[model samples]
Target: MDIDDEVVIIGAGICGLATALALHRKGINNVVMERSETLRNTTGAAIGIRQNGWRALDQLGVAETLRRTAILIHRDRTVSLDDGKVHEILMKGEFRCLRRKDLIDTLYDELPSTTVKFGCQLESIKLDPNTSKPVLRFSDGSAILAKVLIGCDGGKSIVADFLNVKPTKKFSFCAVRGLSNYPNGHSFDHDFVRITKDNKFLGIIPIDDHSEDEKKEAVMDVDDEVVIIGAGICGLATALALHKKGIKSVVMERSESLRNTTGSAIGIRQNGWRALDQLGVAETLRHTAIAIQRERIVSLADGKVEEIPMKGETRCLRRKDLIDTLYDALPPATVKFGCQLESIKLDQITTKPVLRFIDGSSIIAKVVIGCDGGKSIVADFLNLKPTKMFSICGVRGLSNYRDGHSFAHEFLRIRKDNKLVGRLPIDEHLVYWFCAHPYVPGDERNWEDPEEIRRSTLDLLSDYPKEIQEMIEITDVKTLSFSHLRYRAPWDLLMGTFCKGTVTIAGDAMHVMGPFLGQGGSAGLEDAIVLARNLAQMGSIHVESRRKVTVQGVEEAFNLYVKQRKMRVIRLSLQTYLTGMLLGASSHLKKLLCIVLLFLLFRNPSGHIDYDCGCL
Candidate 1:
């Protein structure tokens, strides 16, 4: 077959249709091919247009055209069927809800009918070196030549197969969605409303209804018990806790796959052990992790070594293993990958938070735990930002597979000229190490590259002991990590209690001191256990009063949790920050002062280490 079109779109789904429409407006002729019979086949589905989506549509010059026929959604509602509790939230930014067919029809009407060829399924593709164009063979004994073949076809795309591009598969949660016909008027004030019952949700949006058809609304039957915003350590831990309590929560991770900030290991301290024990993973971790009763510190200037018996309870566990253990406890389908949080709106009635994903999906949780991270968007919901205020920066990573480290599992620290290198054995095959340096004005954003970081760290610790230097040279570049390691002071927590309505932050999102004391990961576990306890308590509460009273109880519990964590986190955060200062001490006087302070602090360990939130 001979084709004249310069561009051929492989699919006529939303992406293909939109691209074709944009090309049409640009006076660039393009053909859209669809295997589907008709656009109206998408009749029952309603698509949400968030602020970002609206902006993209505006650039495509279709925003006004679509908005004229779309329903503006500003208010959202969630009702718990367990009791008759209803929660209302005020939505922000521009939101529109319209039927999928209506959107397709509008985009289709913008183009000439012949622009899209229906029933033309793509069979195979051949790329020609001369034109560098794609030669497409269709299932209907027809062929087309395209200057540019854009595969907008979803997963299982034939074009993708031709290019040998594997489609990324994600576990999709089950949803039963269809049009709920209301021949009579369905009375509702808000444009968007979602009603949820035991493990099932019914989301309905009033139709834009340009036609005289009697159908009044669209219904989305989504079966989900909870929506967790982040898939990091705390997010996974909280999911496990909820799982143990018979409460199912789906973790929403922005990344296509798991990102191990815990690339290698975490210091599971006494507090971490307590929280893990409550979650029932303590024994497993203990078997895997090395108990750290003391740390060996070496001074390169004098070639002297001293061992310090650490007071705070500490254990070094592989970062990946800890996260995997927590994540494994829950059902596999409970986490949704590639679902990044775009924005969050507060539900005024229940004070619960409404989460909006980058994909335009909105979720209302009975409670939303913000375990996103140090630069948490959920933390921003509290009107704060992570201040990059630490004077010391560190690069950390685990060595590639080896037979095993020869020594015991105790931590090793070597210091010279304000630069320090610390190593802890992660397993027989892998050892975790961190290289630290004093903050230099020029050292901004240099840690982005693994090789560059490794080299720079080598330069910083040039005069260190031979074995420590060999560790840096021989370590695999893939496992290395460098970060500013931020922390929040009291001012960042704000004047009001940390818990606002149904939103609360945990892990590095709430407090981010350096890993000097190795308590960063441990502190996060504490947050997870405490928050889960409060939320589970709310779930267990018998609703004698359904509406306002339930809100009060939830809010009171959140406040108490914040109050309980305040003193504990503040003390640890300060100590961890101080430890960073001690690690970077260069002058003789400063070193002496650090040694004395550390000795005293080690002798009189704070009661914080022994404290435990009574087991769930």
Candidate 2:
């Protein structure tokens, strides 16, 4: 086919579309020639639309529409990496980091529907001898004779070649940019920041408020160096641990917001306290709970009592407090909530782990850490066996004494017929209590209702002391929860692989164990500290064209993490397993063996709490 146009713009990118739109506004008929079958979508990251840029958009009658999509930049700051110096200037006019897609889509929508011609790859161009017009020949064996040829065809323009223009120069360094979305809002000032070291540069511009829906759309195919798959204590702590070492990571959480906030509390022994201190949150969290001075053990069957002095710092913290503290300590956009991971596979080209979410969005990460609990998708990707369940389930809740109870700063454990219930004060007015008992045949159905869980727990513990019963009765129904105790076998941790390529597991995902020894949360925190330490030792992380830590570097860091944490967690897991076994054992021989093993392995039950994970 042959066509004739008064004005033809090559390329359908921002320049070509804007040009076409300008010509359309002046009532000058024009057409745009796009080589690909569809508009360019993934060619660029973000464009800093400055004052003149907005003015051009205003002239084209589209500035007002684009203004609503992004935040305004109030200041521009330049950071020099050589001497660690900084220069600042207040922006005189409007500035923003406008997404390329937003601009391209806006321009395309403003133009006439028939203005763009897709699948039109230009082959050559020549001057028509008779009319002196430019003749455009396409690879599809078609031609167009236009009075004017505007070459907006990006870097390699055929029209520019025909005009004998100087070719574009190639540079040694490349630039790649992306937008980081903060669903809960960002803490950065409305500034456009540029950090430069020699020829390398990084730009950070504040965009508009990112909502949940927009966050899901904006990070569809983004790439990150490190991606932590859960936002719980372990995941967020790991991110913060890395952040403490000046490393950035993306935390993908499945929930809409922070979860497990009911009434569950984590006992932070000396080890967990050491990890929190390394993450720089220990001082703040310590004021939230009272310190335990001693422990009390009571036998309901024989009315036998025992007391032991606590050797180190120990406190019970609400799970919500820990989660919120860790989350608030991280930078903006570090954690992306509502991101349900669908599956994970290694990319064929880069061998990096590619995470696919249920929303059809995916991310390619240089390092993937599975902190998504025992049933982690990343662990499944690593082909680790699913965590096995114990014969018991645990029910936990928080009780409030309006008048402030008269209990001392002590942990009390009462046991009878394989049923154990413990209570510890979080503060003067709130008490954290839990019960671990044999799993009933139909206890799974009670998981959805807190009332049923409370009732079942009360029924199971009916033979306990009256004060314990009263504490359970005063507990808030909303804080009641029933969960099956699940753990990865100690032998599995010894023989099975916890890491493959640049992927590894942490927290409950790597070593979930019974809470009898009170090491699950602490062990996870330790995992965070140790993992971050190993990774930071590789080298400084830079957001340049490529990551500093290559595939081999990631593997080496993960191997070190697993190697350091393997025996430590194996010992912890084995102790917790034997504790559960001793409580649930039916035969006298089995019980005796568990007792003998516990005596042999850990002469001091609280000795594990003394080990420190070291500084970040």
Q: What lDDT does the true structure give each of the candidates?
A: 0.72, 0.85
Runs in model 1 deviating more than 4 A are 1-226, 310-313, 348-351, 444-446, 490-496, 542-550, 584-608
Choose the strongest candidate by lDDT.
2
Query: What TM-score does candidate 1 get on C-alpha atoms?
Result: 0.60
Q: What's the TM for model 2? A: 0.65
All-Cα superposition RMSD per candidate: 17.0, 25.1
**Candidate 2 Cα lDDT to native:** 0.85
Q: Candidate 2 on 1-616: residue-level lDDT in tens?
A: 2346458989999999999999999999998999875677545767889899999999999999899888998888999998899999999888888877678888999998999998688989998899887889986557888888899998898988999999989988787877565544567888888999988898888767655665566444444448899998899999998887767788999875567464478788989999999999999999999999999999989999999998789999988789889988999889987688989988898776778877556787877889998888888898888889998889999888877888889999999989999899999988999999887666456477888877877788888878898999988666688788898999988887989988898999999898898999999999999998888786335655333455666788888889999999999999999999998887999999999999999998878888889888
TM-score versus the correct structure, for each prediction = 0.60, 0.65
**Clash number for candidate 1:** 2
